[model samples]
Target: MSIQYVGLKEIKGSLIILEGVTDVAFEEIVEITLEHGEKRVGRVIQITGDVAIVQIFEGTVGLSGSNTKTLFTGHPLEMPLSKEVLGRTFDGKGRPIDGLGEILAEKKIDINGSPLNPVTRKYPRNFIQTGISAIDGLTTLIRGQKLPVFSGNGLPHDQLAVQIVQQAKIAEGKGIENFAVVFAAMGVKNDVADYFRRSFEESGVIQKVAMFLNLANDPVAERIVTPRCALTTAEYLAFEHNMHVLVILTDMTSYCEALREISSSKGEIPSRKGFPGYTYSDLASLYERAGMLKDREGSITQIPILTMPNDDITHPIPDLTGYITEGQVVLSRELHQKGVYPPIIVLPSLSRLMKDGIGKGYTREDHPSVANQLFAAYAHVQEVKALASVIGEDELSDIDKKYMTFGHAFEKEFVSQGRNENRDIDGTLDLGWSLLGILPREELDRIAPELLDEYYKPYKKKGSDA
Candidate 1:
């Protein structure tokens, strides 16, 4: 059977109704060839009877009802895979944008596929030390895990992303060859594009990196295809090529907005202030694609970053992402205002895989104790800040006063660090001890004295007395 666009009829909204296709699978990318010889692609967003709902990828810029032939490739969009993909740049649809040349792909696989069985996924139990102490020391990222970063507008999340790429190191006992990075940006600026290029170039990792950029000015419809294409490439490299891949997608909010826009064009019912009701499942389809297969040496670990509109963590994008991903690295506006770089609000940021990735062979033996004590101490510090706001610091109980000091020290010493600073696991564990030292001996209930004796040192460095 051949695809011939018989006629086009205006549907409910911006969507164009096409007749003549009896059967087409869901989300299949259709190629449309115009009389003028220009070729464009669209997706089979919905189907009813012999009529198909095709959302134009580049939008129907110049088109007529006649002379347009639609070809349903009978498959969803797929990305090309090969080692040659590394350090190359591509547009939203996986076409190379770096201008060097297109990849001579060995094969292409459908982007939409069943997720790895939860039970079959190897538990992520190793940390990736991204040199920034704020991350390695606090909300550590684990390999084979999906831990997102929730940020706000005007925050330095991009800088943090750049820093992670620069500083993130392999877990001990793993060779550098076992690690790789794949970055996908949706609706970002040209300057942002240049920054990543320059940073990777400076680090000399552009060769080992692969970038898929969906710029703000590009067709909004293309945004939806960008991340999936990126992930498909990652899966090929990690699972097929046997290379460990770290996938980072920034501003997922843009991705969601594209979904909503397409939903509106389709005249579908909206949910949560005009967002499509299927958003949760759609996000799940993308996020659940990450992880290490039990039998595969190479794994895909995702760190998706998004800025909550108006700092609303309850926003549909961040809220839904929280449900599907393993954990989050939540940012804080309050902390940002206080001038804490990286400003990771440790109380809210967590890696559910932390337990599996810490202790013994993975990291320092005291890693568990150190993380627990820092978390507990900082939590109490929040309480002290609230109490001090109600009553004077002097009026508070003695223990409350210690909590207050610990809180300040946690931010100034533990959380705040330079962008270039990189801390190893031992240094991270030791730094946690340094911050805990400000509290009196009795306040160290989260950690055992034996552990403390092994790790703890007074905050004051030894002077010339040596």
Candidate 2:
């Protein structure tokens, strides 16, 4: 039996420091008893020469030395793994907040599980259609890759994340038949948290989703452990249960803040802006864990979402994340102010693994051709706008005039969709063709003859109103 110590050390704000403690691991949960016989819970966060710092899960109040007892379970925080975890609301540590008792789980997993060995990882080669033309047709999401949505202050990162999760689905003929999403929110506000809850319920995706939330009001140390705990659960689902899992983590900036705060508390030498020097390596350790395992039936795809501080991409958080992740979907604050719901600035957004995901068997054979044409047309449109600023629009060449028309038409027809619109591949491709119809076939250098024959819009005669 574990001995219960009656010596509760000094209460420094929200933390309780105890001396003469032994055998306590970082993040190990402990049961705390107050003098009034009320019980609470906490975790051992720091170990310093027999001095153990325990952070209370609930705020530490009315607990003093010589009147409290601390018992260590000799175990770190953990979560239950099972299919029943879906559609349930849990705390940052995977404990059910919906009035449910402890889950009779098959396995007890540590939150800080070891990273996936890179040598055993398979190269990712496939597509996951979000059913949104702006994403699939423009910035295609490749299966088994880590693609983050890079946003700035006042951007619609949350809304875009919701749309992606709501519409994301495995390709029609891929090996994976069913997929599930494990979404974890760290340091998010209550309203933003509610939006996700309502969105998942409305889309009926709750049944296939496992959600863990650490709100802004939660303890700072818990915020630090939130992502690791969520990722641990995802690893269990994807690796152990052989399921296709998409793990979405939002507001990573908040996680970094918590890291800096803890590092400051520990009195570690600071890197950039009081961040630990190993911040890059630490972030890589998390993002790199997502990928396709060789010869395994399951794969882990990560869509981590983080907004840049002050819209500065050079911020350490996004800069480090950029280095670790595959590609980025950059959101535009200007576009958000323009009343675009998603506000994804297409020019800067890209999916590096687009080639592997789109082709004859997976998507339409003309997928790449259409994407190239759209990109070229959009670039020309930008050029036209810039030239129109210098020289008058009335003096522009006929080709430039048509390019301007195509750009506006592309944004209105292809990019903008209803709030709940989930377009299929064929529908998205058809929209591309319709937008290309604005340009004459002679000017379509991006498309090949075969693609032209396959998806060409009927040509219009000269001087005919199209």
Candidate 3:
């Protein structure tokens, strides 16, 4: 029989502290029953010297010191796992909110999963085509890498996330059949959550997606567990079922804020910008969960999206995330205001693991050279634009004029594709070659002579300044 402790030492925010408690484990589930028979669930976050600090999943609102009963469940919070989880919708705590009835568990696994053995990790390779030219042709998402998207307020990060969910796929040659997505949203508004649901449903990919949503009005404490629960299900699908899993975590800034609020409630010393000092390790615990295992047929890829406060990249959220994740796809407010669809700032965005995933058999033989030449020429365009602003366009050299024309064509034809338009690797590379062709062949310094000979097209129209 479990012992129920009567009365509480104190209640601070969503945390309930109990003194002289015995045999309580960290992360253990606690049931707090009030005088009026209303019950709230909590998890033990910390335990020291018979004192346990429990974070209530439902915020503590109606509890009193003398009448409350706290029963330790003696086990950590666990999530029910099964193949049935796909195509389902659940709240942040992993409880089904779809009204489709309870899941028949294959087995219950603890949500706080141990990290995979480093020796067992396989190096991530193989491209996962997202069908966005800004991504596939530039910042290519490797199958098992953790690449995040850094965006600002009111940027179309949510739409980009939906687009990825709808279009991401493994390269055609891999032939592995089972692929799944685990999407977790923390503290997002109801309309935003509804948009994701409707997008997945309308695209007919809802059958392959498992959604975990913690709304803006839900208990703040539940935000902390949202990603862990989502990743746990992802691990199950990837390792146990031998399925490739793509986990998309949106608005991680809210999760960090929740961490800060809980830390403040606990009276912990603050770090930079009033956030907890352990923020880096906390984020690492989440981002590092994506990878491929040796001798395993499946992999886990992550695209964690966080809105940069005031468009500041130096903010602790995006800063710490950049340190942990492989690379970042940065969205641009400038391009957004200019009416670009994805609004990806190509120059500032990159994928570190892209090298291992692209070229030859992965995408196309000419992909690396085309990407390199495009980057070089676009960078030149920026320099030319700055000079033109200073000395006026008419005074610039003929080569500078050509670069200016290339820049306009690049943004209009290459970066700004229709929202529903999905371009294959061949089409993206072809468009890139066409844009680069506007420049003289000698200006394509990044391309090797062999590749330039094969794909380069010179301007052919009579009296064409380009």
Candidate 4:
């Protein structure tokens, strides 16, 4: 029989200290029954000597003194797993809230999954097309890579996330039929969650998506389990079911905040910005779960989104995240103000594994050169604009004026696309060449002379419009 103890040596916030406890394992689930017969769920977070510190998932609101009964289940928290989980919606704790009823689990697995051995991990090489020119043509998202989207508050990162879910696909002709998405949102508003559901349903992709949502008003403690539960489902689908799964965790800043709150309640020593010292390791445990096995047919890729506080990239949340993920796609407030749809800064944005995913066989033969040339030309555009600002535009040389025209066309044509528009790789590359046509031939140093001869079209100077 499982042991039940009369607890409550102390109650602090959502945590309770129980004395004289035996055989209580760390992270073991505990059932707390109050004097009035109201029950709450908690987990053993820490154990020292004979005392255990339990964190209540439902919070300790009504409990008083040692009268409450604490039952130690002697097992960690687990979630039911099955292919039927897709198209279903669940709350933070993995309980179905979609009104579709309980899942007939194929098997149960611990939410804290085992890390894949490095020796058995295959390098991520294939590209996943997002259908956005800024991404597919520039910073390509590689299968099994962890790339994050860095944004500021009130930016359209949420919309971008939805678009990616609707448009992301494996390269054409790969003939891989099994693909899915595990989307987990932490501390989002009810309206935001509803938007995702409605969008997925309307787009007809909901059947292939498994959603885990923790609202802004849900118990903060539940936030800790949200991503873990979502990732566990992804691991099940990818490694066992042989499916390519994409896991999207939005607003990870909230997850970090929850960890800090729990740490403070436990009176633990704080690290940077009052976050726990183990924040990096805690995030690693979640992100490292994505990749392909040496001999497996499936893979898991992650796109973790976080809004930098006050637009500060140096904030601990984004600073730490940048260190862990492969690279970042940074959203720009300046570009948004200028009416860019995706508002990608492009300059600061990059994909570290992009080299492996693009080139001869993966994307297109001309992808590398096109991307490099666009980057070089855009970078020069910035310098030319700076010079034009100091010395009036009328004082600039003819070549600088041509660069000015190229800059305008690049933003209006290359970066800006209709919100609903989904461009294929060929179309995006074609548009890149069109924009490069506006610049003089001599300025195209990044492109091979052979490619320039084949693709470059000189833009006729003004007054030739007639």
Candidates 1 and 3 compared: the better one by lDDT is 3
- Candidate 1 per-residue lDDT over residues 243-339, each given as its tens digit: 7788999989989998999898887899997999999998988888888888888888899999999999988898989999887898898889999
Q: Candidate order by lDDT, highest to lowest?
A: 3, 4, 1, 2
Model 2 stretches with alpha carbons more than 4 Å out: 1-20, 37-40, 44-48, 59-68, 173-177, 458-466
Give the alpha carbon lDDT tens digit for every residue of 114-166 in model 2: 76677888888778878788888878888789999888877777877788778
Q: Candidate 4 residues 1-466, lDDT tens each?
A: 7878885899998899999999989888899999999999988999999999998988888997768999999898898999999999999989999999999999888898986679999999989988899988988999999999999999999999999998888885642468889999999999999999999999998998999999999888899999999999999999889899999999899999999999999998999899999999999989899899988888999999999989998988888888989999999999899999799988999999999999888988788999999999999889999999999899999988988888887887789888778998989988888788887778778888988888777654334672
Alpha-carbon runs more than 4 Å astray in model 4: 174-176, 459-466
Q: Which 10 consecutive positions of candidate 4 have the poorest summed lDDT?
A: 457-466
Deviation of model 2 at 415, angstroms: 1.6
Instruction: Give the Å shift of residue 119 in candidate 3.
Output: 0.9
- lDDT per residue for candidate 3 within 270-373, as digits (tens), equals 99899999999999999999999998888999999999999999999999999999989999999999998889989989999999989998899999999988
What's model 4's lDDT at 363? 85
Candidate 4: pairs in clash: none
Q: List the residue pairs that clash in candidate 3.
A: none
> How does model 1 score by TM-score?
0.95
